[model samples]
Target: MTRRICISGASSGIGARIAVDLAREGHHLTLLARRQNLLDEVAEQARAAGATSVTPLAVDLTVPEQVRPVLEQAGRFDVVVAAAGANAALAADAQTHLKGMAWAAWHWEANFRANVLSAVTLLEGLRELDALAEGASIVLLSSIAAYRGSGSGSYGGSKAALHPYAYDLAAALGPQGIRVNVVAPGYIAETNFFQGQMSEQRHETLVGQTLIGRAGMPDDVSETVRWLTSAGARHVTGQIIQVNGGASLGH
Candidate 1:
């Protein structure tokens, strides 16, 4: 049957791919992101991919007030994919002389806001607006860095915070037949995450770490998410599903 789904970060990368994948199943979708132009492009792709309906909403997840009005008008959702996140440490090297320890602290704060709080604010608004349907599925995008650490300490630290939060939310929402889970990915290539900063050596190193001997594509994560939100994964909740291809084995 067709379901009503909401996906944040739907402008590009895994989020856009997920929206299109689900759209092929003819589901109704609400796509959210900060880029209006990109969101519109994704919406067209979703429609072409076979989505029964599509609504694109441009809003910054960092601001709670902006999200409230959107949630208030978007109606209820049966599935929510919190795919918005960033690695703020990429910009840290430019400000290395910002006093004692401030640089490190800034990295932590920026990542927390981008990764953790962005999802929190959206989910919180959904709860307050009573916009989640019964038996809804919620998936938060995380990284294997949460376990093995990333170039930026704050990136991994921020993602790690989601594990316990998912567990707690699973318990709290179980009574209402709502499920919450996480997907931790590693070294997914072609994503905007690296921001064109990935080098050949680093790319080779990450692929080598994977037993599968290949870099992950957007489909690697999106397909996993598709299953998690489907009826096949009805019994799965509060678990961290890793899509790292054995890269986190050392963890």
Candidate 2:
């Protein structure tokens, strides 16, 4: 069956991959991101990939006010993928430990908004837009940092927030057949993340730590989302599926 799907952060990386994968499944997609050019690129690719229809809305999801316009047009979707954020102010306010661990208070708040609320407001705002289909599935993008601690201020903590929220949402909405789950990925490449933060040697070291012996790709995370939202996972909800290559095991 053709399903309607909405994906935030669809301009690049894991989100874009997820949109394309679903598009290949003959789904309709509403792709959201802050960059209109990139979002349009993904939308076109999605159409070419077999999506019956693809809509791109360039919106900065961190600002709650900006979401209203996009939501108005998103309509209802069988699946909603929130993958719109990365650790804010990298290296502790974009500086480094050489600059000290000093970070402004607003920086911590921004981390919360970017990582946590980016997912929360969308799932909750669906009601206002009438944009949540019955038995709809929502996948919130978190990180392995939430579990293994990547040494951060609020990046790990904020991502951790999404895990419990998924559980609460599932319990609250399960009666209505709605499902909510989370994906916590570790060391995923092909994203703007780690740009300037991770060195080639460090990347190699991290990959070595994973039992898989390779860095994770965007497609790896996207494929997990595809399964979670598919009918095969109909009985799965409120779970955190980690795509960490076993890096967190025996920790």
CA shift at 125, candidate 1, in angstroms?
0.7
Candidate 1, residues 79-194, lDDT tens digits: the string is 99999998876653445566558978877888898899899999989999889899999999999989978866889999999999899989989999999999999989987888
The residue pairs that clash in candidate 1, if any, are: none
- Computed on alpha carbons, the lDDT of every model, listed in order, comes to 0.91, 0.86
TM values, all candidates: 0.96, 0.93
Q: Which residue ranges in model 2 land beyond 4 Å of their true spot?
A: 91-104
Q: Every model's Cα RMSD, please?
A: 1.7, 2.3
lDDT of 2 at 198: 82
- Provide the lowest-lDDT 10-residue window in model 1: 91-100
Give candidate 1's error at residue 40 in angstroms: 0.7
Model 2's alpha-carbon lDDT is: 0.86
